[model samples]
Target: MSGMDPSAVPGPTVVDRRRLVFGVLPAAALLAAGCGRSNDDRSDGGRSARPPLALVYNGPQGCPACPETVAALLRGAPRPYRVEYVGGETPLTAAALADARLYVQPGGGADLKGTWRHLEGSAGAIRNWVREGGGFLGLCFGAYLAGRNPGFDLLPGDTNGYIDSPGATVTDGRDTVVPVNWQGRPRHMYFQDGPAFFLDPGADATVLATYPNKTAAVVVAPYGKGRVGVSGPHPEADASWYADKDLSNPDGVHFDLAYELIEATAGRR
Candidate 1:
């Protein structure tokens, strides 16, 4: 948790339908069926008339960046990676999360709430998703979920509410700025503060990035043929998202890292 930037950062809030723009990567085209299933679900690269990927976001409704990101993945993925936003209705069945070859969780605090966390589903399914050749990624709160038992059990971190973090964002007032650590000073950071989650040593998580306070910024864990990755930061958000929330971040706001990671994940299948 050392060598992180010394400020706090945040995640995206709400996303309207119109804000999303869908486009296909013509070179790697496939049918909608394969676009939503993981590789394991398909017999022939998901081109054999089956789904390619199934995403279990299982969180509260009306997430702004959620739909847009899912739309982009379904439309832009080079390997027919179908993306679906599971409305947080019922808890995740052990079979549901296990059926896929890969799973992605964006950085919403509530995304890790309720039956989703503490692994309401079967612990075996959670372990199988990563231990038995399934792939997974967690962002912010999603990363927090990886640490808890019954959850994916990737990074052993704790989630905390905001206190003394330095970052900027708009809440109620125009031009209003909240504090959270971002890329760095004078670099501008946007944030929607969430709970503070720190990594636990026994978890054996492989971290990628973080706040200046040595927190679990980005972490990865390798289990069996399955893999677990997390971003204490939201590297997939855009500028409009931060402006709408009145926040500034320094890690280069426009990010394709999430997609790159997914690309590697999709390759496994």
Candidate 2:
């Protein structure tokens, strides 16, 4: 949030209240509690007594409710963790990153350029933080931002629309579900304008899931001392999201994939 222009920031919305109701406390509270100031402030050598923090990027760039959706998923993670929204008033900073173990970028609208405009200012801080052993998780549009072309450049290569990839089923950006081989098991997950990764030759990347076309749909890769896990679809999406689009996941609303990605990114897996 530091490098962003104050005037460009969007004010708090009703969704902010929704986030609070979902138990995702604000990042400011943690920062105020000496979570980021210094290692001496914490009894566990910089680790706060509070649950580990997972910072979700909530801003104009992300789709409405997507950040809250991701926060809700984190709340239900197998491990105890606290969720916080970062953007607008609480700009992402080095101190904020210090207290957080994982950072997430959720889905957004089709405005890739606009999304980049809002997040480009904090790119350096995010990159540096991940290089210093912080975790990063990108979902949908967030996955696009993790690539080399108009992104955080956290991935070894770039990403492209899944619709454009070979053997793709969904050719349009409509609210729908697509088939994927998740860890060798066939499953259907929500999809919109998700991306497919094109890793550079010799890049050490793990493919957790693959699109029907066999392209990487969910991937995990190392970035310096840290790690990055990304998904092309919305594994964190809930029943309400499907209800809005008159869609449903045959496998039901499961957060296992999301939780696994979080753990992997956080180096817990």
On TM-score, the leading prediction is 2
Q: lDDT per model, in order?
A: 0.45, 0.70
TM-scores for candidates 1 onward, in order: 0.59, 0.80
Expressed as tens digits, the lDDT of each residue in 160-205 for candidate 1 is: 4222233312212122123333334322323333323566667755
Stretches > 4 Å off in candidate 2? 1-49, 267-269
Q: Which residue segments of model 1 deviate by more than 4 Å?
A: 1-51, 59-74, 77-80, 87-91, 111-119, 156-190, 194-204, 248-252, 263-269
- In angstroms, give how far residue 217 of model 2 lies from its true place: 0.1
lDDT of 2 by residue, 28-143 (tens): 31110000010111122344566688898877763445676677677656675677789767888888888888999876534555667788888999998998889999887788
lDDT for predicted candidate 2 compared with the true structure: 0.70
